[model samples]
Target: MLSNKNIIVTGAASGIGAQTAKILKQQGANVIGLDRHPCTENVDQFIQVDLTDPQSIDDAVAQLENIDGLCNVAGLPPTMDRLMVMKVNLLAVKYLTENLVAKMNDGASIVNVASMAGIGWPQSVDAIKDTLENATFDNIESVCDKHDVEGPRSYFFSKEALLVWTMRERWTWRDRGIRMNCVSPGPVDTPILKDFIETLGERAEEDMKVMDRAGTAEDIAPVIAFLLSDASAWVRGINIPTDGGMSSHVMEQMHQFAK
Candidate 1:
């Protein structure tokens, strides 16, 4: 159903984003892959972008002129800068969505590729709320200078806010017939897998119990393809965990598992 429909996939150079761009193209979307690094796939088009800069986002996406769907797969993951994580993961999401929303079809989709680290957003909402509001491309260095977060928590908070942003934007864009949602994957075996496992240290073993196995970019990318396609019409403002029921297992042990 996506034939000739222009779509944008950020972080298309590697991991989930790269896989997602490939999947979308196979499904017939005019895939525009955006990233700081060049992607290997011969996709519909490619535009290098440094998402930390608002102008870069504008210019990279401008290369598309207009698009039907946006897959926000760009991010630094955990074990990276707290502020940059938030900026790339959440702020850039807002930045691109705001700019591209006008260019999208009325019934287009906005899929924010979030993470399992974002699951506890309800509780941490207030703690990181200030940082999210203050995030800006022009002020990247300053935000990183202040309100420093460590380990997976930074990545967690960034995705958490993104999930929240998805829900919020769903309502914000509802009048325009646009839908916003998130896909949170668990223990994906992509390059970032080591980063997450490293950040968790010994706790990684226990965390793995939440899911039967680690996911792959292919496993998660198809879900984004669905959301970006007409397949997921009713899905909006929801974080659909593609972690092989791991999220449920963890949720089941919510009060039982300490840390």
Candidate 2:
């Protein structure tokens, strides 16, 4: 479905990013992989990038041209430093996308890999709006402090802000036929799954007990691939929960719909 397209995938060194690159290549894309480390996936090109650095992102973006799709998949886990999490998970994404959007083809798709942790975005509207308006690479530390986006909360906050940003930019590039969306995955069995369990402790255990199994990168990659393809041309600015019904379960609990 992605034949002849040149797609860029951040975090393509491993996990969902690598899997997404593989899938996109299988579907005939010329994949350009980006990550801090060398990509293990056999993409057409690989660019080592430090998502935390604006200069690094700018240099990487300069090398990109005629891109058809971009998957913002590189992210730091909550166990990392709070400020760094906010930088990679949110700030860098905004910077990268804003800079690269101009180089993308008219019908390009941009898919952000958000998390189920971000589902609480509706509850943080004021903070989201505030961050969207004022947060920049220069003042991210102060922004995090003002919003109490520290510790593990940084991960949730980053994802929440990302979802809001995705929706807000739904039509920002409609004139050029470019669209953006997100994929929110539940706990997936990646190398970082242990980090999530460790951070959330019992809450993570309870969530795991209620679910039949954790998802895999394989499970999440196809949905991302779909969003990157022409098949989803009309589906803009939506977050597809690739989370094995965990999102539905959470909504049921939130609304008291489960008997």
Candidate 3:
């Protein structure tokens, strides 16, 4: 469905990003994969990039033109420093998106890879809003530190911020017809899956039992592909859960517990 369209996939070196790049390529899109290391998949071209660095994003954007779609799939797990997590998962997204938005053709779509960790966004709205309003590469650490966003919490905060930002920017390019949305996956079996399992410990195992299995990149990529295609032209500002109904199951359990 994305035939002949030129799309950029970040974090394309491995995991979901790499799989998404391959899927988009099979759909006939010209895939430009970007990562700190070389991409060895279905990319037509690969650009080395450090997503945490604003200058690197600027340089990468300078080398591109007439982009049709963007998959913001590059991110750091909570295993990293909190400040670095904020930079890679949150700040860099804002920086790269703002830079690339102007260059994207009309009717283009932007898919941000969020996570089930963001399902608790309602509880953190105020803090997330504060971070969105003030977090920059230079000040991301201060913002994260101020909120005590460390370890696995950093990953949660990043996805929360990203999901909220996606909703907030829904109409940002309405005149140009660009749609911004996010996909939230549950415990996906990716390179960083172990990090999540390690961090969440018993909670992760409990979650796995509830869901019966962890997701695969293939399981999530199709939804992203649909979001980027013309099929989802009317969908906007919504976060689609590609998490095998884990979010729904959790919500139901929460309701029962509250009663």
Quick one: best lDDT, which candidate?
A: 2
- Across 58-82, the per-residue lDDT of candidate 3 in tens digits comes to 9999988899999999998888888
In model 3, what are the clashing residue pairs, if there are any? none
Better of 2 and 3 by TM-score: 2
Task: List runs of model 1 lying over 4 Å from the truth.
Answer: 40-42, 138-148, 256-259
Report every candidate's CA lDDT. Answer: 0.81, 0.94, 0.91
The TM-score that candidate 2 achieves is 0.99
Residue 20, candidate 3: C-alpha displacement in angstroms: 0.7
TM-score of each: 0.91, 0.99, 0.97
Ranking by lDDT: 2, 3, 1
RMSD of each: 2.5, 0.7, 1.3
lDDT of 1 at 195: 85
Q: What C-alpha lDDT, on a 0 to 100 scale, does residue 134 get in candidate 2?
A: 94
List candidate 2 segments past 4 Å from native.
none
lDDT of 2: 0.94
lDDT of 3: 0.91
Ten-residue region with minimum lDDT total, candidate 3: 250-259
